[model samples]
Target: MSELLSVQGLTVTPANNPGKKLVNNVSFTLQSGKTTCIVGESGSGKSLTALSVMGLLATSLNRTSGSIQFQGNEITHLSNDALSRIRGKQIGMIFQEPMTSLNPVLTVGFQIGESLTVHLGLKGDALKAKIAALLEQVGIPPERANAYPDELSGGQRQRVMIAMSIACEPKMLIADEPTTALDVTVQAQILALLDELKTRMNMGMLFITHDFGVVADIADDVLVMFRGEVVEAGSVDEVLFKPQHPYTKALLDCVPDAEGKKQLKPIDYSWLEAA
Candidate 1:
């Protein structure tokens, strides 16, 4: 598989405290038709890493170093306009919270069609057909396009978000804890749907999450983050079943087995720091 996205020596720092690096020397590559998951507890810089890749970081945060290459193009220093041209069209993003990411005033279809209109120049019957197909693809009824974001259930709203992200047939997708707010069944459905779509489209997927179970289900490659650094990285089976880092082992121990047979153990940060 070809490399779809690559990041090298990526570093993010708080503007107020230039000395404090929030994301330190991160590096990874995502291949076409593959899902690379970045997993860690909250405050481990997972979301910040994703934002830096998308060029969506807050003004208060800055990428002080590193290069981001996408589809054979360098994106680390592209102008905002250049980035915008590629953002939704070639690189789609599914934010953590669908309710907050979506517009409350517009109908679901309109929001989904927005990018199609902007990127593909579709209109009239063509745009409508595309929107309907996207909604259907995500398992939402085409009729629900007329409904507001608040009217839909959490799972449905997320499905709509998925529809919006894939509207342009992007080459890569960035998903930031996309299933964090859903129930177990819905989470499973969403993960399965994403995996299926990724395979069908041959799109590279960068998924951020704290759940090891989700990683086991969807990831082709796994990168474990701890305190702004990549503590461990390997194939899903290798990292999940035979972690090298103590932090990785501690994290694996925290995940409960399906039969509830494995005892859940909290990470010992004090010992982690000592090591």
Candidate 2:
């Protein structure tokens, strides 16, 4: 019932071009045990928003304005050392691609144990048991913990990423298009796994995806973003079935119905501007 993360008037701009605002006054609140999905086209600043929340924005991008509060404390201005204390401990992040995010040389189990060692100071038998349990929790066999990232399939790699993210039992999880590279079936399975974990851990999940199908499957609350601005935010039913914003309606029109009865329509930018 309590808000775990609240972002207000958040704005991101490229360091070279101060006029270019990547994220424009974006704001939202994520409650514990709930999943909020940010949906939009590529370059819509959805990923930037997530990075900003974790204070993980790149050096080239500047968080010019806004406030980010996590667990009732303002973190937007926190020092790197302070944010580092919370990054993998209280807040976990699953990036878009597991291959790029994970280390190719290290075994999956070792990577999962890294967070525990750093954050919780687990070692020896205790660390081993925790890593094995995490592997099983993400549906990976405990034996596979010994496998390298390249040795596993795409889905397995992602599960490893999930295992790493939740290794510390973070209160909030930020997933940036985590299922984008997987097949439909794998995507569904990943979504189910994430949803189950969220419920079991009572974590506030900020899931970013461009796919409406994923949104329909896992989101409790939906935030529609266009050009860095949230045009609509509401319960899944309200925004998906009875969308009020023109952008929301246009986005809905683009998704084919379950039965394929409704025709899929691409967004008409001119119409969005007009509306």
Candidate 3:
């Protein structure tokens, strides 16, 4: 697979507090048809890192330093207009909460068609046809396109979000805890759908999650972050089975075994103070 995205020396911090880093010198590469999972607890800079790549960092925060290259082109400093052109067309992002991310006032069909209309200039019958196809693609019935965000179940709302993200057939997809709100069965279904879509579209996926279960289910490569830094990075097997960083091992120990045989351990950060 070809390289789809390359992030080097990426850093983020509050605009007023440049000395304090929220994300420090983090780097990784994503290849087409592959999923790279960034696993960490809250405030570990996982979401901030993804937001920086999409040029969606909060106004109060600054990228500080980084180079984000997509399709061999630098995008870290692209203007708003330039980024807008690529945002929904070449790169799609599914935010953490579908209810918050999606506009409640609009119909789901309209929401899904927005990108098709703007980025692809699709309209009229062609637009309607495409929206229905996308809905079906994500396992939602085409008829449900008329439903509002609140009208759908948690899983359905997420499926709608997935449909919107893939509507324009972007080369890269960023999903930030897409399945966190769903039940176990639904979560598994969403994971499978995302994997299938990635393979079918040959799109590179950057999945952010705190769940080690999720990392095991979908990641081809893994990056373990703690306190805003990548403490370890490698293939899923290498990082999960042969962790070299203290933080990585601690995080893994917290995951309970399927048979309820292994004891769950709280994360130990004593090594941080020593380092």
How does each model score on lDDT? 0.93, 0.93, 0.93
Tens digits of per-residue lDDT for model 2 on 1-275?
66899999999999998789999999999999999999998889999999999888999999999999998899988999999999999999999899999999999999999999999999999999999999999999999989999999999999999999999999999999999999989989999999999999999999999988889999999999999899899998888889988878888888867784656676867866576
For model 3, the run of ten residues with the poorest summed lDDT:
258-267
Q: Against the true structure, what is each candidate's TM-score? A: 0.97, 0.97, 0.97
Which ranges of candidate 2 are over 4 A from the true structure? Answer: 260-264
Q: Itemize residue pairs with steric clashes in candidate 2.
A: none
The segments of candidate 3 whose C-alpha lies over 4 angstroms from its true place after superposition are: 260-264
Please report how far candidate 2 places residue 184 from its true position, in Å.
Answer: 0.7
Q: lDDT, candidate 1, residue 209?
A: 97
Candidate 2 displacement at residue 219 in angstroms: 0.9
Q: RMSD, model 2, all Cα superposed?
A: 1.4
Question: What TM-score does candidate 1 get on C-alpha atoms?
Answer: 0.97
What digit string (tens of lDDT, one per residue) describes model 3 on residues 130-239? 99999999998999889999999999999999999999999999999999999989999999999999999999999999988899999999999998999999999999
Number of clashing pairs per prediction, in order: 0, 0, 0
